[model samples]
Target: PGFDPAARPPAPPPAAAPPTAVEPEVTGGGSRLPLLLGGIALVLVAALVGVGWILLKQGGGAAAAGTGVLIVGGSPTGAKVVVNGTPAGELPYVDSSALVGSYEVRVEADGYEPYTQRVVVAPGETAKVTVALKPAAKATAKVLVVSEPLDAKVLLDGEVVKEGGPAPWQASDVEAGKEHEIVVQKPGYRDARFVWTPEPGEEKTFTARLAPALVRLRVESEPAGATVYLDGAKRGRTPLDLEQVDATKQHRLEIDGGRCYERWSSTLIFDERAERTVRATLERSPACATRGDRAPGKKRSSGTAPAPRPKRRGKGKLMLNMRGAWANVWIDGKDTGKQTPLINYELPAGTHRIELKLPDGRSTQLTVEIQPNETVKKTVPAP
Candidate 1:
C-alpha cells in the first residue's frame, strides 16, 4: 500500500526528466573546438619559446666577432715599424690585424739602430714573427794635422793635420778608405810630406809649404873702440849676416863702450834647419863716457855726473860691442847674463841703463853716459 501511494505521485514528477535533452555535442567546430584547442596550446608554447629564443640569439652573435692576427718580418728593407708609439709602417712587418692584443714592436733601419719586441695576438690567432736588422758601426783612422807655421800646418798624408785656428779643417774618423802618412813641420818652415788617400767612407785633403832659416852674425870692439848692438839697432863692423832670418826668429844682443869694455846682453833663438854663426867681442866699462852727448834718437838728461876717480891707463875704463840679435842682459837692475857676438862689457864710470832681451817678449833700452875712459858700440834687431 505505501509503495503504490508514493509511486503514483512521484511518477508524475519523474516526467521532468525530459529537460535533460542537452544536444550540444558538435565537436567539428562547436564552441570553437575548445577555443581552437586552447589556441593551439598557446601556439605550441609560443613556438617552443620562439625556437629557444632564436637559438640563444645565434649564440650571442657568434661571441661578438673579434679575431686577431699580427705577423711581422724584418731585414734591411726600410725597417721602421713602431707600434706603441704608433708609426706602424715601413719594414717587413705590418699586419697588425688586431683585437686580441699586447703589442709593442719597433724596428728601425738606416744604417741600423732600432729593434724592440713584445707581441701577443690570440683569439683565432695567426701570429708568427721574425726580425733582424743590424749593420751600422764605423770608426776608421788616418790623421796628420799640425801647426807652427808651415802656413799653420794642416796636412793629411804628411802628418801636421790642423792648426790654422779656424778654416775648413776637419779630420773626422779617418781610415774610411785609409792611406795616410802626411807630415808637415814648421819653425822657420821647410818640412813637408804627402800621401793621404781616403775612400772607404771617404774623406781626405792636404797642403804644405815651408822653408827659411840662415844666419851669420859678428861684432867686435874693445878699447879698440867699442860699439855694437843687434836688437838695439846698429850695423857696420863685427861680421853680421842675418841672411834670410826666421830660424824661429828671436834675437836681441848688445855690447857698447870700451876702455876695458864690460857690458853685454844677449837673447837669440834660431834653428830652423841649423847653421848659425855669431861672434862679438868687447871689454871693460864701468859706465864711462861723461861729457854730455845725446843725439841718437835723443832723450837722456837726468843730471848726475861726478864720481870717477880711480884707474890707471883709463881711469874708470869701459868697453862694449855687439852684433845681430842675441840678448838677455840687464845691469844696474840685475840679471846681467847672456850676450853673443864679440861679447864684452865692463864699466865703472857713470850712468847706464843698458838692457836687451828678445825672444818674442822683446825689449831694448840703452842710455849710456860714461866718463873715465869710454868706448861703446851697439846693434840689435830681432824679435
Candidate 2:
C-alpha cells in the first residue's frame, strides 16, 4: 500500500541520457543550411536564364531601356515575316525590344512574289518596313489581234475562233511557249496565216493587214452564146473572161444555153494568180434551162366543138430516186428533216444541194436544178 512513496529505486538513474550525441565542431564555423540554400538559389537562376533564352529565340522579348524596335507591314496582311533568315512572326508584327542593327526583312505570301528589304534600326527608335507584294503572273498567254477590215474572221490553228465580233479580237488562256498558228480571213481579202510562239506571261499582239486575193475565171462552151449566172447573179455569156473573182471560196455558176438550157449547175474554185477553165456543153436534161414550149397540145373532137388545150403548170418537178445507207439531204445548210430514199420528190425551181451523208462520216454533195413541168431522175450510188 506504500509503493508509490519511493518510486521503485528512481528508475535506475534515468540511463545517463545516452551521452547527448556530442558532434565534432567544424573549424571554420561551416553550416549545411547555407550551402543547401545556395544550391537552391543557383538552380533557380539557371532556370530563369533558360526561360529567357527560349523567349528570345521565339522572335520577341522584354527588352531593357534604350533598345530599338522593329515594325513590319506587308501589302496583304498575314504574310510570313522573316528577319535575318530567321522566321520572326506574321506580317504586321511589332518587335518593341530589338537590338539596333541592319536587318534583312523578308515577307512571303501565297500566290505572290516574296518581298525583301534591308532595314536599319536606330537605338531608342522604331524602324518601319513596308512592302508591297507583287501578284504572280499566270503561265497562260494573252493575245490581241487587230485587222484592217472590221468584218474579218479570226482562226487559230485552222479552227475558227471568231466568226463575228467587234473590231479588235482577243484570245485568252492560250498555251505559252508553244508554236501557235493564227489565221485571218475575209470574204474578199487573202487569208493570212502565220506560226508564232508566245513567251511566258507576255502580251502578244498581231496586225493582220490582208491583201486582195483576186483571180480571173474563163468560161467556154461547145455551143457558144450560153449565158452564165454566177452565184444567182447574171454574168456575161460564155467565152468570157471574168476578173476580180475571189479565190478563197467556192463559186456556183448556172449556165443557160438558151432553149435547151437543161439547168446546168456547177461549182468553180479559183487559185491565187491562176486562171480557172470551165468547159460545158449545152444540152437539155431537165428542161429547167428553158421556159418550156409556149404552145399547148389540144385533143381533136368529133363534134363541132373544138378540143380544149391542156393547162401548163408553172411549178417545177424534181423526181429524185436517190437512195443510200444512212443518207441525209441538206438544202442551203439546212437539214431537210428526211433521210434517204427520196423517190420522185418535188422541189422548187432553183439550184438545190442534194447531200448523201453515210454512217462513215463521208458526204457526197450534188447540185441539181429542175425546170417547170420537167421530171429528172438520178441514181446516186454510195460513196
Candidate 3:
C-alpha cells in the first residue's frame, strides 16, 4: 500500500459500486416494505394466540376436575327424591357432575312418612341418602248414653248391663254396628225402650223421663143393677165406684134379668191411661117383655114364675187394618163408602154381615155375632 495523500486518491476507483439495489416483487408499482412489516405483525399475533389457548385449556381442566358426582339411594326403592329442593327423579338418583357442597336431600312416598337430611359432598366423592319410611296409624270413630234420676237400670239388647248407674251414664268400648234396642226400668215407672246405631269411636247421648204406674176404671149402666166382669173376673154391681184395673186389657160384661129381660153380653175398652168408664143399656126381649105382659106396670106375682126377663142388646166396635189391599167396606149389604183401615166403628151386638169388595168384582164376606163394648180388629192381606 502506498501512501497517497496526493490528489485525494484518484477517485477511489469508483468506490466499489454500491451493491445493486434489488427491486422487490411489486404490484401497482408499490414497494414490499409494508408487506414485510405486516408479516412480522402476524407472526407476533400468532404467538400471543397460542399462549392464550394454553392458559384457557389449563383453566377448563381445573374447573372440570373441581366438581364431583352425587348419588342418592333410599331404603324404599320407589320413593320420590329431591336434591337441594329440586326434583331429582326417583329414590336412586345419580348426578354425574354436581358442584362440591352441602346438599339438602328429601325422600317421600305415599303410605309412609317422609325423610329429610343434609349431606356433604366433597370433591370427587359420592353422597347417598337412605330412609326407611314408617307406617301410619289405623283410624277409628265413639257412643255415649245419659239418663235422668240417678239410680236406674239400663238394658241393652235384652242384657241388663247397668244398675244404679250414673245419671249421665256412658257405655264405652261397645262394638260399632247397626241399631240395638235399649231399655230403661225403675220400680213403679213405665218401661222406656229405644233403638240406636253408632259409628266407630262416635259419641251419642240419650235422655229419658220416668213415668207413673196404675190406672183406674169406673162402671155404670142404664139399668141400676148389673154384674160387672172384667177380663173374665167378676167385679161388683153396676154404678160402681172407680176400681183399680189393668191399664192394658179389655173387660167383658154379662147381664141377666129374671123372665122378661134378655141376656146381654158387652165389652169394655181398657187402654193404658189414667181413667175410663163402662156403660151399657139392657133391652127387653121381643118375645118375652111386652106392655100387656107387664100388666099395666103391676109387680109380677110372687109365684115361682121367675120374673119375666128382658132381652138385652149391646153394641161393639170394629177396627179394620189392611195391608197392601185396596177394597171398599160393606156392612149388611149397604155400601159404607169406606176403605180399609176403618177404625172405631160401632155395630149392633147381634149377628152382623161384613164384607170387603175389591175394585175387580172380588169380595170377602163374614158373618158373626159381636159382644157389646168389645173391639174386634182384623187385617186382610194383599191379593
Candidate 4:
C-alpha cells in the first residue's frame, strides 16, 4: 500500500484540500478592533451634537425655566396698569415671559378711583390680578368776587350773577376742576376779565380793578352864549358841562361867535379822571363888520343933490327877557334880526309896534315906547 500512493484511488483527490480562510489586509500595522471602536465613538458624538442643537433652537435653556407669567383683568377692560411705578400694559393683558419678582400694581381709568395692590410672581407660575373700580365723587367750589369800585356787576361763564348788587359778591355751587370766565363791569369803566380754575371745595376771592374810560369836561368861552364844538361835532352852547367825555386821547375844542368875533380852537388831551375845563377867548374880527355892504360894482344913482337929512336921534336900549320860549323880535312890521333875551339893544326913541313871533307860527303884539338914552326892560311871555 505504501508503494502505490499515486494510484490508490487518487485518495479522494487529497481529501479535496479543505477550503482556506482569507484575512483582511491591514495598513500601517494597525488592527481593525481599534478602528471599529473609533467609528462607534464618532457616531455617538454626532448624535449627541445634533440633540444639543435642537434643544438650543427651542428656547429651552436655563434662562427660560426661571421666568414667570403675568395676567391683568378688571371691571373696566381698558384701564391702564402700572407695575412697580412703570407702565406695564392695559387691562385684560397677558405677559408670558415676565421675570419673577414682587410688584406694586396700580390700575387707573377716567372717572373712576385708582386701584392699588401688591403682587408676587413665582417661577413657572402665572400671577393673575383682578380689580373692581369705583366711581369718583364730584366736587364743587365757591367763588367770591370783589371789584375796585363798588357796585360793579359780576358775570360768570357769560351769564350775569349777583346782579343789582355791590362788590364782594359770592357765587356758590360752581363746578370745580374746569375753566370759568369771570367778568366785572360798571358804567364809565373798562371791563375786567379773568379765567380761573379752582380746586375741589376751594373758596377763592378775586379782585378786579377797572380803569376809568371817560373824563368830566366843562367848556366855557370869554363871552357867554357862544356855540361849542367837540371833535367837529356841535356839543352845546358855552358854559356846558359834560359828564362823559372820551379820555386818553386828543380832542378838538372849537368856539364859534356869529358875525362878531373870530373862531377859537384848541387841541387838548384829557388823561386824568378828574374834572377838566376848556376856556376859549374869541378875538374881534372886522371881516364880518361889512357884511351888509353893497356889491363892489354897484354905482350910485345919477340925480340932483338930495335935501339935507334930518339930525340923527339918540338911541335907547331895549332889554327883551323871554320865559319858557325863544322867539324872534319884529318892530313896526319889520324883522329886527334878533331873538328873545336880547340884552341892551339900541334903537331910535319912538313908539313902535313890537311883535314876538314863535317858531310854531304863533305871535303876540305889544305897543312899546322907548325913551332916549334909557333902557326899557320887558319880560315877554310865551304865547
TM-score of each: 0.34, 0.42, 0.36, 0.39
TM-score of 4: 0.39
Ranked candidates (lDDT, high to low): 4, 2, 3, 1
Name the lDDT value of residue 241 in candidate 4.
95
lDDT of 1 by residue, 84-200 (tens): 677878767646456555667778877676778877666676776678877777547534443334245555554545655634355668756556666665454556566666666
Task: In model 3, state the lDDT of residue 345.
Answer: 85
How well is each residue in 71-97 modelled by candidate 3, as lDDT tens digits? Answer: 777567878888767778886778787
Better of 2 and 4 by TM-score: 2
Off by over 4 Å in 4: 1-68, 73-80, 90-92, 99-101, 108-114, 122-126, 130-143, 147-152, 171-180, 185-217, 221-226, 242-383
lDDT of 4 at 191: 82
What TM-score does structure 1 among the candidates reach? 0.34
Q: Candidate 4's residue-wise lDDT over 1-383, tens digit each?
A: 35865666643444567889999787887767888999999999998777655644433222333778878897798899988788888888788877666667889999899999877666789989899899887788998888978789888999998674564888678889999999998887878888999899999988887767787888776566678888899988878898778775667777776655556665665442467776554554445333232222233356654663344467798888667688899876699899998889888886556667777655554555578899988885453
lDDT of 2 by residue, 1-383 (tens): 55587566655555555557878988776778998999999999999888766644543343232468899986788999999898999978899978755678999998798988887666688899998899876578889888867679999887888895657888778878689999998876788777889887778889887766787777776456677898999898878789878877778777776543444566664434455666554443344333332211222334454344344446565544444345776654588777766656677665655655555454555566666777766666443
What are the RMSDs of all candidates, in order?
A: 19.2, 12.8, 20.3, 22.8
lDDT of each: 0.56, 0.70, 0.64, 0.73
User: Comparing 1 and 2 by TM-score, which wins?
Assistant: 2
